[model samples]
Every structure is written in structure tokens, then in C-alpha cells.
Target: MESSSDTFGKDDSADAKLQESRVVTEEEWLQKWETNNIGFHNEQGHPLLKKYMDIFLDGRSGLKIFFPLCGKTIEMKWLADMGHQVVGVEISESALKDFFTEQKLSFSEEPIPGIPGKLLKSTTGNISLYCCSIFDFTSTITGKFDAIWDRGSLVAVNPCDRERLVTIAEIYALLMLRATLRPPFYVPDSEVKRLFGKSCDITCLEKVDGLAERPKKWGLDYFWEVLYMLVLK
Candidate 1:
């Protein structure tokens, strides 16, 4: 007879395969937010970010930081409090509204030229959020970022969109800046090597265990959270 642990392991493996086989669309993500199925949303800034942000800071002040698929994460507020300009791109208008309202930050909205969405700017103009698809991001519009904090944005995207996501990073990242990326799933080092080998140098790659409390699809008690730092070569 199969033990419960064995059954859970099998279920987890099946769930992983299922996720790999499907493409998650923008509308599906919006629905997830609407239903409050956002297990990914962290009320506090991510622990890893709290620990490692100084590496990105490196004695700099007032650096422009970009968060892709930002999703109203408290990390943006934390970054703003650190004296850096926080720019985020999100697709859900509800999430954007919630971010400002919940933070009690006054903001004004205006349309973004050459894009189909509006830009939400905090009263101090230090935090700017573009409500649009990340693919539509352009330097001409948002300008370049001194640093990028991509907490799970890469892993949250469908496999087909991953390459484009990297391209967008390339276009927006400052020449000497480091882009910090965190993947929610198990991303093997070989896969990371394949993706960023040619154009970027990987400065850090660490697998952080026990970071998530929720059981993974395969019912694992904990999953590895991979942190990667990529610098353009």
C-alpha cells in the first residue's frame, strides 16, 4: 500500500508537469487577483530582498529601481522608503488602486502616450506605476532603471514569454546594473546557464530552501526559491 507521503509526492510531480504544459494568460492572472487567489502576494517585503538589497544598492542613493509585473508588492514601498525611485509595471487596475489606497499614499493618474494604459504616480513623484503589459515597456516612455528587482516575475510568466521578458530586461537595465531575479519553481542551474550564458554574466545563484510555507502542487512541505543575479556582459 502506498503511504501518504508517496501519494503526495506523486501528486506534486503531476502538478508540476501540468503547470509546465499550460500557458497562463494575462486575463487568467487578472481573474486570479479578482478572486484573491494571489498566494504570491507578500504583505511584507520578501525576506531575500531585505537581506540582499544592499548588494544592489552598493553605496548608491536615489537609484531608479524597476519592478516587473509588480502586483502591489510591499517591496516597492520598502524600496521607496530606502530613498530609491520605485517604478512598477502591473496589468491589474484594481491592484494598482489597492496599492495606493492601502498605503495611504496620494497619487494622480495620467495616460501614457504610445501605450494603451495610464501611469499612476505618487504625489511625491518618487513612485510611478505603469498599468500595462510588460512587453509594452519602452525606455522612451519609462526611461531606464538603475536596478531591477524581479521577484518571481520570471517564474510567474509562461515559458513562451520568458525570452521576451529577458529581452525587456536587457533593454531597460543600466549597463553596469545588476538585475536580481527570483524564481518560484525549481530552476536548474543548467537552464539558467542556457538562458543568460551568452549575453550576461551570472554573479550569484543560490537555492534557498524553506522559504515558502504553503505546500507546493506536489504537496512538498517546502520548495526551493532560486535567486539569480545577472549582469550584462
Candidate 2:
């Protein structure tokens, strides 16, 4: 495993810039979805989620799972089908719509009062998606969840906003994320501890090099994805 400094160092300007670019505005994310530039999405859902299902469930069922920065991820459907209530917060309206349409799930949208967007709920009421900035979608709005699956959400967050986010997590949130570099895009173990250690007990469940074919796509010689489970104390 590379040191956090090695991952976050500015020695590679191109890599640094590429990672920095991921901290884009909500509009930019919306544009990415509109143009179908979502290579971050996994069509079959995340393999780790399946591989570690036992850990997440812990011999329990009827979990209320949460997904942050969810972009038409098929994982939500998978959990809902298993009789768990799935709640997700997404910035792109189109992404939310695509999730329902692609999953062939009947849903209804109701304007979320005081927000710029609406809440889309499946007809079965097992899955709920709120189209709004993640920062705006608070626990007060959606209540609590048994666990949070933060695949790409934390990595895409602006660094300046990270501390505030960590502070907010004091009230709610915990789990894993995907990042190529450290800090704004990639968060190494040290970064994870630095951000959440004070409020949560952090455990790194897994860390692996990116897929053999993905380095070229992300413009990096190597990319790493680390999955951590955080329990707020």
C-alpha cells in the first residue's frame, strides 16, 4: 500500500489535476449524466456489496439502506427486491428518473417542500430517491438508516466541504467510497482517520488496486479503491 502522501503529493500534476476535476459543481454532475459521461457507474452493481453482504446484514434483515450520490445504481433495486427499504440522495434529476425507468419500477414524484427538486418514491414504497444536493438532503429529511453505502459520494465532494461533511456525519452517515487519488478524489486510510476518527470507529474492510483495464481510462498508471466501514460512536 502506498503512503497517503505518495497518493496526495503534487508530484504528478496531470494526475492531481484529474483528481481535482472530480470536485465539480452540481450542475457539472447533472451535465455529466445528461451527456452520458458516467463511467463511474457499475451496471451490475458493486461487486464488493455482494461479496460482503453478510457483513452488511450481520444476520439481520429488513435493513433501511442509504445511498449517497447515487446515479442510477442498480444496487438500490437489488436491496429493495430483498425487502429492504432503500433511500438514496442524488443531485441529477435525470439520474433519479433513469433509475426508476431502467429498473422498470413504478414511482411517483412529490415536490420536496423548500427544496429545488422533488422526492421520487417507488410504487411499492421500498425505494425512495431525493433529487437534490447531498448537503441539502439531511437526516432530518429522510430519518436514519441501518447503513450507508457511499460508493463515489465522498470522493466527488469538494475538499473545502469535507470537514463540514464530517461534522455533519456526527449526526449520521458511515461507510465506503471510491477515489483515484487522495484528498478530494481519493481518500487514503490516513485521510479517512483524520476525517472521521474523532466521531467514529473506522475499519478498512478492503483495499485493492483498480481493475487491470481501468488505469488508462482514468489517465493514471495505477488507481486504488478502498472500502471502509465507519461506526459513529
Clashes of each: 1, 2
- Cα displacement (Å) at residue 113, model 1: 0.5
Candidate 1 local lDDT, 169-188, one digit each (tens): 88877532222233344334
Runs of candidate 2 exceeding 4 Å displacement? 1-23, 174-184
Q: Output the number of the TM-score-best candidate.
A: 2
- List CA RMSD, all candidates: 6.7, 3.6
Candidate 2 lDDT, 1-233, residue by residue in tens: 22233233454445544564345776777798999988788888888778777777777689888887788999899889888999988888899999999999999999887767789999999999998877776777877677777776667777667787666555665443333233236554556777777877766666666655645666656667766667777
| Count of clashing pairs, candidate 1 | 1
Q: TM-scores across all candidates?
A: 0.84, 0.85
Task: State in Å the error of residue 217, model 2.
Answer: 2.1
Candidate 1, residue 59: the lDDT equals 78
> What's model 2's lDDT at 213?
60
